[model samples]
Target: MFHTDCPAREVVDHVTSRWGVWVLISLRSNDLRFYELRESIRGISEKMLAQTLRALVQDGLVWRQVEPTTPPQVTYGLTEFGREVGESLAELFDRITQRLSPRDAG
Candidate 1:
């Protein structure tokens, strides 16, 4: 799967990117508005968040909904496929955290 043009590689890159993983994990539990998502993922700049969301949406891993209103309320959430991927990522993240804790490391 290491071939330069492998499609899985692109998917993996998107899912495992520095911000992508965090985004997926954050959206796994609930859909969030742009600002809500940005706030939840601390330290992520507005630009980065937008870019990440765009990629996820294009990949069919996320759904972007625009509510009709004066200001156009926009929300982001994981697709069914995204939920599955996010679930696995969440489990992996938890395991990593557990293993790295001082109590576990000792």
Candidate 2:
């Protein structure tokens, strides 16, 4: 937890939350439809994913686009700022995974 109360701390909490990290990492590569995001990140409930996306959008870290088609297609992707942060998060995620892998327990 961050010791100081600052805007940056709130943003950090949002990005580093368990669900937030997965959402950001999933969108880092390409824009994804709602169902696609659900498929990409397993075990996340529809409610939670929606909430996560909404928070990211509010933070300007994610972009939500709605196509005015017959059914109104909705897609989510990383914004310019999001891409920067996503890339950094991706790297940190990778490092965390590698470091915590069973092979490293020796």
Candidate 3:
């Protein structure tokens, strides 16, 4: 797993990137349009969000669907594999946040 040449390294990097995990977790529950996703994840800039979504889509962790409409709406959601990954990441996130809560910080 630690080998530099390992293919999983790229996937791991994408999955655990600064915004990757958050993106995955955000789309886990429901499909969301670009603006909705940006709103859901506070403090993320438009450029950063676009880059993150593009990476996730390329990795097959997120599915992007474009609707034929006046403005051509685009939505993002997690794939089956992505859902599994998101579930695991969500659990990890919960544990970390719980441990770092004010009550636990003596």
The number of the candidate with the highest lDDT is 1
TM-scores of all models? 0.91, 0.85, 0.89
lDDT of 2 at 95: 81
* Candidate closer to the true structure by lDDT (higher is better), 1 or 2: 1
Q: Candidate 3, overall lDDT?
A: 0.92
**Per-residue lDDT of 82 in model 3:** 92
Candidate structures ordered by lDDT, highest first: 1, 3, 2
What's the true lDDT of residue 45 in model 2? 93
lDDT of 1 by residue, 2-91 (tens): 998998888889999989999999999999999999999999999999999998999989999999998989999999999999999999
Better by TM-score, candidate 3 or 2: 3
Query: Per-residue lDDT for 1-106 in model 3, tens only?
Result: 8999998888889999988999999998899999999999998999999999998888889999999999999999999989999999999988898889688754
Give the local distance difference test score of model 1. Answer: 0.94
- TM-score computed on alpha carbons, candidate 1: 0.91
